[model samples]
Target: CPPKIITKSATYVYKLSFTALYTVYDVTNDHHMPIRLKDSSNSQKTRLQYASWVGDTNALAMVVENDIYLRQSPSSEEDYRLTFTGEENTLYNGVPDWLYQEEIFKTFEAIWISLDGTYLMFASFNDSKVGQMNFPWFSSNTVLTSDKQNDRFFFPASRQIRYPTAGSHNPEVKLWMAKLSNFSNIEIVELTQPAVILGRNMQKKHQ
Candidate 1:
């Protein structure tokens, strides 16, 4: 008997099968092939948070260390860096922040690939000005004491998370579109809010 090939949900572009490993389905030939990253080191893999196929093509986009990386194919060594403002716990590209995940998108993704696979649109978040809430977290693991009468205690550690309270500074968000091409000079366009919306926001601030 032949091996069974299982596929996941179908996007606007292609039907992808993501299980233990990321696989790309070739529509033209109707076959499944495993995708491999150029950098497969543990450190690089650790930094990678999200990765997905771009449209109906074999091109791939990954969110690594809050930055966006694009490649022509899964095995391409010369990948393109779409964003550069990704900083730890401050700025994020191609992925939403905590507030957006919980309130706006209700998903972990903030990217949209064109059906033709020629363009990529994504959102960036700047949480640098947002206030962080710090609190103590008690660990579940028990530590044994070095004494005749053995005793166990849980250690408390300080935890911090960026949060936007009412009337507080919220995360700055911006939408961007990039042209996916073979050349090194990738054209990126910023999609700004309309004047009407901007004026309404300004009016609300003044009130």
Candidate 2:
């Protein structure tokens, strides 16, 4: 007999929209409708990067504009903001930066949910001091023209990326944890690294 291909029913399927927005669809219902945020304003939706359900629960954890947001329930209207220092490419909350993705974690997110779904932990990255590398981009349809002086000219455009080279300033990473509840009184506590990892230089720098 051929291998039995058993298919299990899924509750939700996550998807990224064409406009780079994140959406979740509930499959339990016959209509299979999308789970929308309570305040699904165009601006809010546009800033959302990704969303995922908490462990075995209807609660949702999401990242919007590099910051973290938590909703206790799918139908709840209140969205709890987690971190306040998320800046576009310089600082990231609940997500990894370019260095972390390329050299360290090799993943897009740095968020973790507790098994009981009572707490959420995430990593914040600050790459403000890292050196940047610029890349020139040209479209396939770009046309090249030569001047009478035998010089070629094209569009003056370049893409800049924060890159840390050997023995350069690395990104500062911090771990944060928050307890989840129905109320709005959420407190974030920073977790510190071990003494062995901090070493003498790290301790002196902090001092």
Candidate 3:
């Protein structure tokens, strides 16, 4: 299904206006609506829970919910309009997925408009090799082809995740930076030392 479209307006005058949009689904009806708040507005509304935004006073450096989206402004409207598909890769800007944020502890994965609100930065995780495991419990105690007995069945294929433990090998980590003006000019920063550990200890002596 196609995404819904919505419009918002500002209430107060400022250098910029920031707004956030969220979607709320109606479990009873299986429908959704978009929620938005402009700079001048102080109240929040409940709507579809698809997208959210945090904009600066001037409406610049607006952090969108998803990665890729389309922005438009009608010739008559004063504020810009946003429409997005539900895909994260296309709409969000700086946020990473669950694994990258939780497992890797990467909190600041996104870079949005510099001090001047002219540039943006974003990071991505590529864990294509990760695998999954599936077990069949209902088939337990059943007899299969030939002499095979099934008490518990494991899937023939399993997913392998590259996780690093205290003494395990870790994957290579790299940092990338890009200018909003020219996304093609991405710079990759390599670290000479990939891993580091810090610890603290306390000792007390009786006087």
Candidate 4:
């Protein structure tokens, strides 16, 4: 079967003029409509980064500017903040830090929803002890003439991100799970050694 495309606003909503309109669209049937999400009172509502839909429904697990937000249902408007320690370069929530991105996971996101859609497991990386790396990036589009010798016109911008190399400090990684009903912290994943958990089985015990 081929996928249907929305060519006009009559078929699908192309634009909307409203503040705090987080919409969810379902296109399984005809006359696809958008469900507007309710907004939270959190003053810092930035753009979403790692937005993921849970199971086969409209449940949304999203990351906005590194913090995790959960919406249990499509018609619900309350956004749940699962983790609160999401500083730019210091701490990460539901996502891997720079060290895990470079050394372990090799990706930005470090989260996975359970198969039954009742739980979510995500890794938290605390890089407060790790060092930093800095570099300069020159824009390829900006034209730099050799005739002009002024250092100010060079526009060499400094780029910085936490980079852990070799045997220095690594990110303190820990896994956490939260229930879907109230988004409560259920269990903490830990390993005193490899291939072992410090507590009871997360699957059987938490359920």
Candidate 5:
């Protein structure tokens, strides 16, 4: 899970989690909770891990776990104060999945901002056509039968994010900017001709 970020006037507090445990780390104080091993019995137990923060204090960035839905909250006591329901076939703002992040070099998946304490931004991706990967495992218990070793395999659905290879059809990219206020305005910048590279050997590269 991603840490809970609490930003005060001059300090930033991060409540990070690893496996099933959590710790508090502060940026202004330059301090971190004592590191704990996942398995004390094994000397090589893995330590908790977390994504590093990027961008300035006002526009913070972090990764969420397992392609889960995310929302903005004003306080920890309240649930997400804002819900983002993006297009039916696209990721709701944030980093792309593992493949896109590693393969396409799209590290930061989403963009957020704090304007006068009101958070806002455009963060979404459309990967409805991406391919799916699956795994097989044995069930430890079954309620319908007495067998505990029931074997099963399944291929969950996934999207193929129209990744562009060396020479492949690339999806059209569009950019938009909007304001978060009553009677807010939205500007959509359209690109009639896709971006193309001009060079000696890679003169026609499209991005």
Candidate 6:
């Protein structure tokens, strides 16, 4: 997407649906100042993050619906789907999972486009084995929307997030590097180092 123009004079940011007028599936020409595009598919959040033009390059990358999309240039009619493992509340690409977001990366996204835009490095987290933690939230409601006949009163609500505990299965982290030449190619590097165990265990893996 083209960089958004900031109007410092009457500074205000607003969310509007651009898909109504122009669609990525329909457009071809890139106008001056480039137009920012959005994912046409309806999503739970309907929002994207970690969007930026590759450092000193014409390519663009963004996280939409927990999946990463890349384009050779801003003028590209459609973006290439770099990852397909992203599932709703499950697998994520270029973005950290719940545990990593909370305790690991301590940041929103876990992706880095190279300074020269020749390569991209990212972290992939597998939290399928991790357990979920739910916090109780008391709410007073006459009828729960999900329940019919208004039979339920004072429904219990809770917030659930994946959190690892002692002796629990920690999220397995993996690193991957992708080169621009082969857009679909991704190589995984296993950094299986038992740094905590200061002896033969660490040496064995390195060897």
TM-score of each: 0.73, 0.73, 0.33, 0.65, 0.35, 0.63
lDDT comparing candidate 2 with the true structure: 0.68
Cα error, residue 65 of model 5, in Å, equals 9.4
Clashing pairs in 1: none
TM accuracy, model 3: 0.33
Cα shift from native, residue 17, model 2 (Å): 14
Candidate 5 — what's its lDDT? 0.33
Considering TM-score, where higher is better, how would the candidates rank from best to worst?
2, 1, 4, 6, 5, 3
Which 10 consecutive residues of model 1 have the lowest summed lDDT? 10-19
What's model 1's overall lDDT? 0.70
In model 6, state the lDDT of residue 81.
73
Off by over 4 Å in 3: 1-66, 70-93, 106-109, 133-178, 181-207
Residue pairs clashing, model 6: none
Deviating ranges (above 4 Å) for candidate 2: 1-19, 32-44, 138-156, 196-207
Per-residue accuracy of model 3 over 95-202 as CA lDDT, tens digit each: 444345555654524434355433434443433333322343333335445445544444343323334455644332333343333223423332233333212222
* Model 1 Cα lDDT, one tens digit per residue, 1-207: 322223343221101211133455656667775443456653332234567777777677877667888877755667778888998778988877777876778776788999988889999999999999886765453454563155556566666767899999999999998888753788999998899999999999999
* Per-residue lDDT of model 2, residues 1-207, tens digit only: 211112122221112111134445444542322334556763553335557777666778877768888877655778888888898779989878877866778666789988777788899999999999997755542445445255456675676778999999999999998887643897779998777877976878989
Q: Candidate 6: what lDDT? A: 0.60
lDDT tens digits, residue span 1-207, model 6: 434312112211112111111112312344333324434543322235456666677777766656777776756676777777776455667878776776657676778878888877777777778888887655455457777465766547776656789999987777777677655554444445466775777678899
Cα TM-score of candidate 1: 0.73
In model 5, the worst 10-residue window by lDDT is: 8-17
Record all residue pairs in model 2 with backbone atoms less than 3 Å apart, i.e. clashing. Answer: none
What CA RMSD would you report for each candidate?
Answer: 7.0, 8.1, 15.1, 9.9, 12.0, 8.1
